[model samples]
Target: MVEAKTHLATKPRWLTPVLFSTTIFLSASLLFFVQPLFTKIVLPHVGGAPAVWTTAMLFFQTVLIGGYLYAHLITRYLSVRAQIALHLTLWALALFFLPLAVSAGWSYDAEQSTAGQTLLLFAAGVGLPFAVLSANAPLIQTWYARTGGYSADDPYFLYGASNLGSLIALLGFPLVAEPLFGATQIGWGWTVGFWALGALLLASGLMARGRHVRTVAQTQTQSAPSLKTRLLWALIAFVPSSMMLAVTTKLTTDIGSVPLIWVIPLALFLLTFVMVFTNRPVASMATLRLGYLIGLGVLAVVFSNLLGIHVSVWSAVLTVVAFFLTALYAHALLYSERPSAEHLTTFYVTMSVGGAFGGFFNSIIAPSLFNELHEGAITVAVAAILLLIRAVRPSRTALFGALALVVVILAKTTLISTFGIFVFGAIAIVLFLAVATTIRHTEHALAWVIVGFLVAGQVFVNHGTPLLRDRSFFGTHKIVEQDGLRIYGNGTTTHGAQRIVDLTADRPEPQLYYHRNGPMAQVLTSAKADASGTVGIVGLGIGALACYGQPHQDWHFYEIDALVSDIAHDPSHFTFMSRCAPDAPTHLGDARMVLAEQDGLSFDILVIDAYSSDSVPVHLTTVEAFEIYLEHLNDDGVLVFHISNRYYDISRPLGRLAETLGLEARIQDYTGNTAADPGDVGSRVVVLSRHSEGLGDLNADPRWTPLASDGGRVWTDDFANVLEVLNR
Candidate 1:
């Protein structure tokens, strides 16, 4: 009995490590959960632009730097008890701003900068709480390091636990929390979680009472990291941070800007941290080489639009894979270069600084500097260069041979469009040479070669320059003349097109989805006889529907992006808006908000044609938004939704909303001969009204079928699940 009691007393208490881990986990969960929840709440206010997420990422990163700075300072200078007191005080103070919500008075203005406005809103809403939560990972890990408990000497593993919590929260919000709870409910739930985390923190501090206090003499004896090491840490961190945001923009711009898409990239990012910091087996050199090859393939697809692979499931998967590999590689390097636990806070502070700079570059610098959405491609190029720099070493003879081969390929692909696959072949050869070369070091030569190839590909891949390439808070817009037609493009999708030959015509024909043979024309033509009242359009895509207006009717356009509005008004780009509806007034703001504010204005025909690329602004399709539309429509007014998309089957959800509202609806899937006239592409439109007579001939036409609900969930402003309507 004496021997057993002694063994039991000597046995380590398991509670300390578990206690600290749990505290870090809960704090991380709260931090990530609020990101999507609050961003989703702010999305509609900012026109539901995907850039809103990019801007929010910037804000979060900047605040994370602040949090890490605080941690670094307190851990370096203060006593353990002092640090605990200060942090606990901060936790308590953050509670005053809880039950996270945006201010009711705030609203986005088109004339104001979007990034600035979004930053201000986030700062006002959840900034303090997020900062407090951000500090926990580094702070708790430092405390654990000083506790002299299990694995305390190497406390970086605790970082893995923090990221594991982050991963769970990010994935759960989209897959579970968001689907199950509304925004308000999620906010309140997060507040409760925050309180629980505080209690755990207090308990953790009490457990480590007097045990974690460090002597000034002990601190002075520890060596600090050199400037070069600190800079390397920041650079290694910056690559993945920038790449994450860039890939997110690419995904959200192509697919719908929903929480599911938002979470996938971020989850993968956190997963990388979890893997690297937990001492999980990383990819081998051979595996990394394979990843480089895949990265090149991704570049081939992105730069050249190879195989017409724009916005498809496989394309998205490939992009995500490339991103994952790049982030894993960069973060593994970061882990390999980690400082000892004594300098933990300083290490994290540098990492946060790098991440903040990356966010700033992607969110602020890139957009302002480049005319197109080139940040993704640019980051990919940088990643390629960095990987090559790390992996490549060449002899003088090999370097000379590579330079000679590049010259030959450049000559052969001077007319790149004609060479077809040769361009990608050249890119592959250059990258392969960079990888296969062996010597002491030739990273600079390899980097320059990669950059040269990328620049050449970027310059030569485009067959012709755009007439106008403009970017706004909403997205990138391009006007190009192709196939005897002038086209307006947003991302990978064509917004509108007009026949160049029809420039002399008094009223040029509407093209693309608005072609005379399409459902848009059919509906307008059918309603023309009695529809002399106001005509309201939600999207001003080159104002293609403007020609449908009669002299007796009044036309108004609601366009969210001011840049798009400016382009539509410029006759040099497209003559559709200038010639068709030169006098029509265009409202600049989100369609839902603007429409709700239109006091007594009613429309005989209301067209919601605002979908850009394949991205759906979910807020506009909700039941509440439909009610708002109904408020602005005449008793028998017809409502039209342009549902043409390559990635989503949203008609079912709209049909569900129509069923819930007890409205009559019909859909027309119009197929046109684009082979003969590029402007006459296919279109799908859904028309709804309070009465069947409002649909006129469309109700009886065989081409127009009754819209099917198929029992999908009715989306509301409070809740929406994009996964439900995703096209398989």
Candidate 2:
């Protein structure tokens, strides 16, 4: 209960904290829920392109800065009651476009840049809502201070709680909200929460009407921080925060976008902030220094071994660990140097600036500036510099020595890629020497030199476009050429490939999904067997299925990303559409929506291959999505699902869906290993048919077997239980 200091104060002691926590929790949760929901709604219009996330992030970061600025201005100019009223009024105004739906008639084409389109659409969808949401933490803290409720030291603790709310929202929205509620329900729930917050504000205002309004220390202090301090704080907060995102991009795109992959780095980043800000000593200088040295060394080794071996499950785990530990070290540093509550708005604003910088580098700038996701490498270097910036003792001289050693090592090893690993190890040794020297000046210089060389060497690797290809918001699409086959890969999934078989041929030969023996081949053959039968492809991976089509069959491609279509149709690349089916009907958007739109159309075979191999688009796996496939298919139509994963066993879920629907499904194990069953059998093709005769036909095939499932839970568009089926 929090009672006001003024004579008329009537609020209970627990009221303020309770209200504050709720405000933070509900607001953060609702805000994040909107992120995925809105993305899902407009996903079809934008073509589930990888870069969409990046574009959305940019909008979010920029808008967040604006929100913080608005909060600062309101705190400065308005009284507590006035600010509360103003915020309420704004809330009411925002409700006009309630139920949180995107504009109708929004159209996406195959030619648009997915990153840019997503940013624009997202900004339009929730700019005001985001602004309102971003201001909540700062405003509530300021309100607490104005009403003479808390000490200066208490505000940061509250901020930690606020972030806890953010973490919950991030975790829960994907797990609970998306699966439980539709977009309409999510929008309404958010609206209700917003109104509740407004009510809380009113209750607080009424309680504080006569309270003794003692000026807080923050309010009384008029001295502004120097420009340098402001700039430094902003840099410190912003760079690492943004770099965390950059690191996420690298790990997910360059490494893999498998579910739970992004969570690792983000969780570590948040935990670092928690440790640094808490009244705990877990973020000791010694621990951070050791962690930094180890993290940097590990990163160097990992990056240098980019192509030494194929990216594997073990490597993914190791990379996540490296990212988490390094990010923790860097972010903990930022938390250690956090500004006073009086300067919090400035601190947050600056943090947003750094975040924007990191995002810009990773999302927007990195694609054009360098090739690969140099953001991660760049972040490692930046983190090193930031770590050194915090040093106060005699390690400065040691830093210089360490820096010199790294420079020499890099120069000596520039010609050999593997030499980078040795350099990293040697740098760690120099860092240890710096820790031992007890000389401050030398450590600072060494730190600078190490940072410089690390960055310079990374840039050199990024220069000739050998290490990286094209990076967008969705992920990094690397161009790998092997034995004359040009491969375009996102995460671990080879989305597109072209063989340079004909050296003199203008267009590359279609490879991977577009190859002759792929799943699309079966769909085309079945469709060709019946000229009047329609064909529908659930997942449009570069429109590869269009290649196997005939002029007589009604061929339609359901693609989520127009960007993929653009890449596939580009004459400069493999011309699948032009060469195979010139006038193929391509529906741009989520396959589910497009399928639902076609009520009467029936396909002889509906192909389901929606997302990357690393990530199974959950919506596509749901019972509702399966029903759509069945409805669109003829009585004897086949539903071919491409279930290929290196980690999780998705077969059980498909089997369960088949059992639940009383449909018979058979699996085709396309990849077989004679050497040994490395437990990694690729591409389990689940063929489902409602008709028993169709099942009989599949049963006749020697490769087909009776699918078995526990028949536990069935996932729908609005409800799913992956926890039951997920691989532990």
What do the candidate models score in CA lDDT, each in turn? 0.79, 0.61
Q: What lDDT tens digits, residue by residue, belong to model 1 across residues 1-728?
A: 56544543463668778999999999898889889999998887876778888899999999999999998899778877888899999999999988887788887786788789889999998888999999988989888776556877678999989999999999999999877878888888888999899889888776655433333345443589999889878877887788888878877888978888988989999998998786664665445444443454454345444323255676577667767876776776778778778788899999999988889988999889987767766766666566444433334544455445433443453423346457657666765576456444455545555566656666665557888887877888888888888888887788888889877778899888999889898888875425547999999988888888888888899998888889889887777778878999999988898888779899989999999788877989889899999999888889999999888987988899989999998898888897877778898999999989877777888999999688967888778888778787
**What is candidate 2's CA lDDT for residue 214?**
47
lDDT of 2 by residue, 1-728 (tens): 24433342555657666766677667766665566556656644554444555556677778878887888888777777787788778777777756666677555443566567667777677777777888777777766555555553346666666666666666665567755666567777778877786777566554433356444453544466688776666665555555566555554443333223444555566556656656664757765655555455445544544322234555555555666666666566666666666777767777777777766766777777764555566666665555555342224433444345434444453423465445454555655565556454554544454565455455544344532355443455565566555556665467765555532353334445444544344445543335535777766555545656666777777766555566666645555665665576777766776777767788877788776645546567878778878888888777777776654557788888888888888776665442342212234577788855664345576666677886666655545444455556
Question: Which candidate number has the best lDDT?
Answer: 1
> Highest TM-score: which candidate?
1
User: How well does each candidate superpose onto the true structure, as a TM-score?
Assistant: 0.92, 0.80
Task: Name the 10 consecutive residues with the lowest summed lDDT in model 1.
Answer: 409-418
How many backbone collisions does model 2 have? 39
Instruction: List clash counts for every candidate, in order.
Output: 0, 39
